[model samples]
Target: MCSGIRTNLHFPTCWDGKNLDSPDHQSHIAYPTAGPATFDTDGGACPSTHPVKIPQLMFEVVWDTTQFNDKNLWPEDGSQPFVFSMGDTTGYGQHGDYVFGWQGTALQTAMDNACFGATCKGLTTQTTATANKCSVPKTVNENEDGWITKLPGTEA
Candidate 1:
């Protein structure tokens, strides 16, 4: 044998703005009467509904070959040293420096590796020329395939 009880649930009727005299007139409003109340009783502007303007960042790169070479001149250390400089300016300031050390087969190999995917290569040579008289050449290939070009004549 089994026993069951029946219960009744009632949902109040909704009221539109025109039906102010209706029993469920409060339901005409969009919000529920028992739900959390909004700070804007009269429906003030929503804090998150306003449009916000974002700032745009501007940047430019200025290169002074003279300044770059002057700062990156590596002093003689018995072996020839190769020098290279790169700059990237995007909202950030200019950045330049030298990557140099040693010479011969090792130096060549290092330069080859450094300029693997680069558009230009650092100077490579066997002679340990003085900083003032040194001719730093740029390479088009990492494997020393094409002719290596010297930087435009500039005061060391």
Candidate 2:
């Protein structure tokens, strides 16, 4: 059986320098450009519309399918047996949202110093155990685990 699947996500880094967000939640930001010379690389510049360039946010996720490695566990027709929590079976529909949570200029200061991970001068760092102790009041009152009829916040 195959090991697993890994996906890389690169969030838009160019901001409109006006609105922090839009009705569709995407109009105010865009990916950087290299002007057709070559695919946008590390040195790519933001477009005129979104003149303010921000630090890029990237994520890497690894899905574990080892428990279902047995051929008998798969569908008889040989279709993929995985479906994302958002009901995306095609995989292409996978997406994520972001909300700025850094306190004050914490993020901006760190970015300016080229800090990677938790090495910024003024930024604070905590162990995984300490961070795990943090929690917030549940705003969405719903069953978030086990089998469910549909994903939360997705109404027809």
Candidate 3:
């Protein structure tokens, strides 16, 4: 029952292969056995414009916030706020495709807590300025704790 705002993430496909001088070379080179399969092919010689799949060593997550709030959360200046906790579980080669599939989960906390909070117990901090303005706990002693500590004998 987690709900706040939702968005889509896109990933660019890439290949891991050796730079070959010509396309005629098709000998199966011994690729790195540790990770995904790799081969030697002419650079940028793939016939199709679409991306080709290769050994997926890493992946990233990206998001667009344009229509997030209007979809689910309250409508504001298109600035929807929410906390996202994501991690990959499915190991490589789970899917038959050369690209590996990943399973992830995201939890939606309070809007204010997720959007403008300084410190969260189990969530990552997003904004330091918002945290400072909110007077959340400070990591350093020099930080003011929402109090004006003045000298007793100072001139009024």
Best by lDDT: 2
Candidate-wise lDDT, in order: 0.32, 0.73, 0.33
- Count backbone overlaps in model 2: 0
Tens-place lDDT digits, model 2, residues 21-105:
8999999988778531222464388899988877767665677678778887777998767777767877776566777788999
Segments in model 3 whose C-alpha atoms lie over 4 Å from true places: 16-51, 55-156
lDDT of 1 by residue, 1-156 (tens): 112122222222222335434365333323223322223331232123222211111122222333223323433563322223222222223332223335556655544555322333564434323433655687564564322234335434
Error of 2 at 39 (Å): 14
Cα lDDT tens digits, model 3, 1-156, are 233233322222232344422253322222222323223322333323223433222232234444443444533564424433222222222222123233232233423244223444445555745644654566777742222223335555
> Each candidate: RMSD to true structure?
33.7, 5.5, 20.6
**Can you give the TM-score per candidate against the true fold?**
0.13, 0.65, 0.17
Candidates 2 and 3, the one with greater TM-score: 2
How do these models rank on lDDT, best leading? 2, 3, 1
